[model samples]
Target chain A: MQDALHAALLPQGLHDLLPPDAGHEAVIVERALASITAHGYERVKPPLVEYEAGLLAGVGAADRDRIFRLLDPVTQRTMAVRADLTPQIARIAAVRLAHAPRPLRLAYTGEVLRVVGDQLRPERQFRQVGCELIGSLEPTADAEIIALAAETALGIGITGLTVDLALPTLVPALLEAHGITGAARAELETALDRRDASVLAARGDEVGRMLADLVNLAGPVDSALKQFASLALPASAEPDRARLFAVVAQLRGRVPAVPLTIDPVERRGFEFQTGLSFTLFARGVRGELGRGGRYRVAASNEPAVGVTLFSDSLLRALPPPARTLRVFVPVGGDAAKLREQGWITVAALGPVDDARAEAKRLGCTHVWIDAAVSEIA
Target chain B: MTPPPNLARGDLIVLAVPKGRILDELRPLLRAVGIEPEAAFDDDESRQLRFKTNLPSLEIIRVRSFDVATFVAFGAAQLGVAGNDVLMEFDYGDLYAPLDLGIGACRLSVAEPSDLSQSDDPSRWSHVRVATKYPNITRKHFAARGVTAECVKLNGAIELAPSLGLCQRIVDLVSSGRTLKDNNMVEVERIADVTSRLIVNRTALKTRPEEIGGWVERFREATARNA
Candidate 1:
């Protein structure tokens, strides 16, 4: 019964990050945070839990059904374990740092718990480290965020990184301005999402051809833009197209080696994004390294661009982390010197009979013997 | 016994494809996409689970229809062909379905025995007990209508549920009315239209865009030919 009680059983979608992976995840978080901070991003720590309504107010409203809520005994108000940190960051930018300078750069790193794990990410809890530029709408700002994300991945030795840029509202804005609304707009959105040009053709011919022209404009940025260069667009959507083009152009100059793709119709995960949104992926990795784009601060109309890297996936994609060399030290010996020599000292509490055996038992790779550290045999 | 070869990270690209009925239509699509798997891949009698393809670094993994989504989502396999039904049921944020393969056409439906349908008004029901493979989708569907759906999660044999008193109604995939009639049940509502999709991990698509995107275009061409 005791053994059974001590069993490492855990709920589905939850896991214990044993040994090196746990330490590796922390290292990745630190390294990514360091990369973002180099660009003048100050770090902020949000509470792991917050008032449900406040946390779900703006960009986070999309994660409505996924938050875990509990009643607070003191205030009698419902409290929520945060499922996402972007909304919390937005709230901070809008309220707490309301008086801060323009383009408020804030970085954060922490764990989030979700009610159910998505298919790719089966962990109910995972770490998210991100930087949010809270007050700029320029295409240059978008380029900077993308470049910073690329730099973070590059810092960790991820090469062949590709950025998929999307103008979520561009197509919808164009269709609406061109008299596609209500059921028609929804149908067209579905058609574009599925790449089903037939549905567009069956419903309305003129709109169908226009959508075909737009949806076909997805590929390498240069070719895609050249296609968009000739096509007529709705008058109102001109700025959106222009901004996306400008962002792409600026991003090209900054990260010359990174490949870029443009897909104008993808809005599945970018519900709250106002203008441009981008997702980052690299060769051979299975999930997105990070993704972010444009959004407004909680109460302000100002634009913001940010990216959040998934620590778990990043660690998985990275090579095995370097283990700290640990040496077993005898009691009343030069433990401080071992520390100064760069060995992680595991000191014995008392005088030991066999330093080698003690080192082996304690899982230490080395032992202090006769004033010198030697490999345990 | 030796375990299957472990693919070193970035050394190879894996494609997860469904093993059974769907493969009948999928083989031609694979051909159109110019992917020719080894002879052992098509052998139902073969115990081997993974097979090498004509391309040096690409391979095929045969698995259950639902598992295709999981494997691709987790990055065990970077690409997969899965039905939207499985996609909706799992909802993996990391799995991005770029193209609808236009194969495996079907619909998910709610069904009940014919006798129960005459006197029972589903609209007036406050609560329902349903046996289904898709409990999440079942609950969400009924919840949207202000009805409580208590779903008993089951793996297959949904046709026998009503007779066995497992539940009054069952939600299952309907390829035709034959299964419903044979079970003394009738289709009452459609949950969603189903179709196979070419899904890729969002990260995989970005990191290896040239290779992944090339396959996407090939599959798109194949799908276009099929259409």
Candidate 2:
């Protein structure tokens, strides 16, 4: 039988990002930040751990289960390791930059640890690079964040990328407008999320018909909107429909090259989404590269839209970074000089007979001997 | 992914299915979908984790019920059969449940020993301790009713907990309620009805809509015919 240590091994869903891949993820994140930074987004650094109350406040309240809680040794109060940086960034925007200025453009890169990993993301720990455009409730701001996400993926050299835009509140507004409230409303919403027509039809004739029509309204952006335009939407929901159209129009005008699809009533993972939201994906990639949408700050009376790129999956979609020639130099050699020569330099810590073999074993392609470099044979 | 010696071709699409009873129920659906697995796939004695299907582009993997969502969500597998019970517990944003396969029907419920349940009033309880496979669902259910639930997460054999003093109640999946009855337990509150769904990676559907949509349609038709 295995020992207790073996039983204790790998609490599941935890993973280590190693070597070239780890560095590649970092580089991709940096380039993505640069792309967003070009759009006037300044960087922010939030603490890795915070008071559970602060972290769980407002829009972040739903993530209570995802957080890893620990008792603070000094204060004896509950603390939480951030499972998501978006909420913390939202908190930062509301408090730290509360008085900074109107329309705060903030970017952040940090590691988040989750209590458990999901189907598409099985890593408990991963890096996130994201940007938020605050203080804007405009359709242009929503469109800008979407364009920025697509462009950022492009900036990281990812091609054939697609951005799926979803309006989280559309259905709620529709259901409320149609007088489907409380339990019935939630049940109807679940039916929509699952695309289960049977459950939807069981609700009632009129409600079922409207929801089924709404489900059919999801497809390519142009076609879905055309369908939405034809429908006689309620007066209360007209504004939401109008804003969605405007956001789509802005995206079409700004970045026509990036293919955009519409999922009008998708509410999953958009718990904090207030208006237009989007998810980023690339051709041949398994998971979402990034996701962002419009949301209201929990305490601060400001509107915000942000996009967070998951480096774990983003790097997977991206082509492998061009390998830099790695050269090994014997101890006492000028390793720094080789670095300036545009090669990754490794230094031998101990003496070795076969310099070539040592260099290859160390993952270096070249070895230096007597101030001369030669490819490992 | 590299193909094993047993597989004839390259790794194409991986479909994750929960092992045991669900797999048994899914056999007819798989055959209806026009895919046939190698003979070893049905061999209970075989210890293989993955099996080759007649369609070279498609493969099958058997894992824990909870893991189907993870595999598909991560894109390690493009398609999966996952219960909404697992889906609700994990709440994977990356997964898209396009269809309810209408198989593996059950309900997630709150249960207690037959004796305790007779005297128990779930509505009057301010705080409750429970054993459950779904802590998130349990907590959310209790929280919705203005009750705080302290949950002890267990993998299986939850009915034994109530009698052994692990907890007076358990939140678990109830199919025919046979296990609960055998253990002298009774279900008090049902959280949600459960069923298997055709879960696909959200990105996979968007990237290769034709291929993924085709499979989704086949599964949908097969389910409809069976139903």
Candidate 3:
């Protein structure tokens, strides 16, 4: 009994996906991949594990701690399980497919394993479905990626979506312009990251007051943009604000039905991002459904942006998929014909006394009788 | 069929509050923010854990002071009122202490027996043992100054530890210092000045900015009125 109990236990933040959930996850991945592929994005499959040096090169530098590493016995070299797939796509774009094309579009779906988990999202092993557009510096690229993300989610039955746009570089650019460096810069950054307006208000400096005002500008797009347009920004940080406004305008032009909001100072989880970023959320979902932004490809330094959807969070946002109608076929029945008719046919291994009773026992909705499908209930 | 009022707008927003002396100071603040809980909430003898407010989209849950941070950090409750002492002790990255409520004034201090304090020098100490409900804060406070603190965790009656030889000192919240005087102890050090804060879940703030940010603004005005 003790051994059985121990066998049932898995390591923290890891679990098995069983039954209807596994099937539903597969459906969602396939639907999302097809939708992305329809927009001329080709699918690519990266391995689950790779050499630590090759895996953690370039963009993977910041993610070293989160990756699960082990030593390869044959080669005696270190290997690592990928904690994220976007870095791999970047590596491919820079190395393997370096000469493929300009503004290369690649889509991917695979499982990622992490070393640790936080209280909010405890799943260490989960699937990621995302697409990256590499080698583009256009604001339209940002707008396209965001619109595609929202459309892909809507195509998969997610509703009430809101995309919150962020400019991670805006505040840092402001601080650089002000020459506020050393400990003061670090303190102000922390205060901004925590959204602590009180601490910023206490500073009472011009920069401090500006940052406090930015903290309060995290709401709807029109009103926040109205307030943002009136701010007296330095010449250096003005481009970031202008670029954010342009992207917002483009996104509205592209997907006017989807809700858009602005958070000018949201920099967390976008440390690697270089420019405009956005996070997708449903009305009542607990966490972000998907997020992406502009980042420079590590090795090539080509500007890029991508969106990755957490399958676990996406599953929660979507309503449970409708159950497929399964029809039970007894021995000598035309199971193939039943399947061709768009019914999931469960074939009988041996003869049964009653086809309807057998269908009910096997959890089928219908049974094959006299060369025709009959409803079981 | 018509939907419930809370669901009609969105998910019901749960606000967690501490269940002790802080509740007395919080009553008027809650009213100023336009939240009035059911009459049974004031009885003190009710076993109820959750109570509805006058607002259709809001509700309140009474929990232990320390647990208030845990609830909001987990996003089980989208908003809460907790002392900074609990915030520092947990240091949950998911919480954003955006506003200081200016209530529940106190200080987290280290105290010991009067005789020990008379001849004791904190600078000369190499290692010290202390009892506290906030082991994280106590250890961190000592470690910042190149000292090692062996903390024995206790939930309540931390003042009894020093007198019973459990430890030479205890770290606990001191409001008036009367509890220490009654135990024949004297204050040795103050870690931080404590006050209740308006804590919002990081995710809630991002997902529902209008609703949650509106609440923060409302509370800001309420605190200002009280000041």
Candidate 4:
């Protein structure tokens, strides 16, 4: 009994997806990928594991700690289980399809494994579905990715969705402009990451005042933009800010219905993002549904932007899917014919005295009786 | 954990507050922010966990200090008042401490018996045993300076550990010198300054910016007035 109990226990931050939820997650992933692929983003399937150096070359370097390492038996070299699919997509765009097109559009959906999980996202292994547009530096590319992410989420029934825009590099540029480095920079980084206002209150310098204003300036796009326009940024960061302004304007024109907010200092997950980035949120959802932003392809200079949605979080945002009508078909009944009419047929193994009782026992909503469908009730 | 049923009401907001000592300081701030909970909220003996405020859309829940970060971080409660000590211990990424209320002034410090500190040199020590509620912060503080800390967890009355020989040292919050003196202990090193902050859930601020940002602005004004 002790051995049996031990066998039932899985590793922490991992679990088996049982029954309807498992099926529901697959359907959602398909719907999401379909919506993304509809925009001519041809799908690509990357392996679950790859050579460590190849996997962790560029943008993937940030995720080195999270990737699970294993020694390949053949080459005796280290292999890493992919912690994020964006890097794998980047590798493909650089090496496999390097000469394909200027703006290569690729879509992928696969399970990713991590060494551990954070408190906000506790699933060490979960599916990521996303599309990346490579070899494009245009603000329109950023706008397209944002619009596609919103469209995919909206199409899948995530209500009251919000797309929060952030420029992760903006704050660092501001700090660098003021010669803030070493311990002081680290302190300010932590303060900004936690969105703490006390740091601003304590530091009364010109930079401090500017950062505080920016923190308060974070809000709805219209008002925040109005306030942001008056704030002056260093010349070195002007291009990034200009790109953001362009993307925001383009996004407003394209997907105006989706709510947009900007936080110039949000630098949590976009460690490698060089330009505009956005995180997707649905009202009342526990965490982010997905996030995407601009970056360079691994081992190459090709500019890219993509959005990766968490299937688990997306499931949380959506309502429990409508139950499929399962009709109990008698042993001799035509199961295939009933299935064609959109009824999930659960056939009887043997003849039953009462079809209604049998249907109720098998969790079916309907029963095939007298050559017609009848409600279980 | 399942969120509270009222969380589904987009118009309503929940503010989780620490139940004990900080409540006195928070009261005036709450009043300044135009929030008045029912009179029962002030009753120590009242077995209420939640109370309706003067604001029709806002409610307040009183919980343990540590749980305030937990509540707000999980989006179970959209807003909370938590100390920086608790915030540093948990270091929850979901919580954004946008305003420093500047209340609950204290310091998380390493404390040992008065006699031990007389001969003890913190820089010379390689390893030490401690008793405290904040093991994470204690371990981090010691590890930063090449000291390996073995912390024995104690929720309350941490000062009693040294006398009982459970541990020779402790890492706990020091508000005044009275408690350490009463327990025959002295502060060795201070880890971080402690103060309560106005924390908002990241997702809450993102999804309901207008409503949540409004509260943050109001709190900012209230704190500025106090300062």
Highest TM-score, which number?
4
DockQ scores for all predicted structures = 0.41, 0.31, 0.56, 0.83
Q: Once model 4 is optimally superposed onto the true structure by TM-score, how far is the C-alpha of residue B124 displaced, in angstroms?
A: 2.0
Index of the highest-lDDT prediction:
4
How accurate is chain B of model 3, given as a TM-score from 0 to 1? 0.96
By TM-score, how accurate is candidate 4? 0.97
Alpha carbon deviation, residue B180, candidate 3 (Å): 2.6
**Clashes (candidate 4):** 0
Model 4 lDDT per residue over A1-377, tens place: 34455767888889899868899999999999999999999999999999999888777887888999999999999999999999999999999998897799999999999999999779899999999999999999999999999999999889999999999888888988999999998998888878876698579888888888788889899898898888888997888789889999999898989999999888888888888899999998999999999898866888999999999899888899898789999888888988887778899999899989989998999999889999977
lDDT of 3 by residue, A33-145 (tens): 99888888998888999888877765567578899999999999999999989889988998899999988999999999999977677889989999999988888888889
How accurate locally, in lDDT, is each candidate? 0.83, 0.83, 0.88, 0.91
Which docking class does model 2 fall in? acceptable
Per-residue lDDT tens digits for candidate 2, residues A261-344, read 777777787876788788887866776788888888887858888889888888777778787678899987898988888777
- lDDT score for residue A58 of model 1: 70
Candidate 2 chain A, run of 10 with poorest lDDT: A2-11
TM-scores, all candidates, are 0.85, 0.74, 0.94, 0.97
The digit string of per-residue lDDT tens for model 4 on B1-227 reads: 23346556566799999988999999999999899998999999999898987776788999999999999999989999999999999999999999899899999998899999888877788999999999999899889889899999989999999999999999999988799999899998888999999999999999999999989989989999998
Clashing pairs for predicted structure model 3, backbone only? none
Alpha-carbon interface RMSD of model 1?
A: 3.2
Write down the worst ten-residue block by lDDT for model 4 chain B. B1-10
Which residue runs of candidate 4 sit more than 4 Å off their true CA positions?
Answer: A1-5, B1-8
- Judged by DockQ cut-offs, is candidate 3 incorrect, acceptable, medium or high? medium
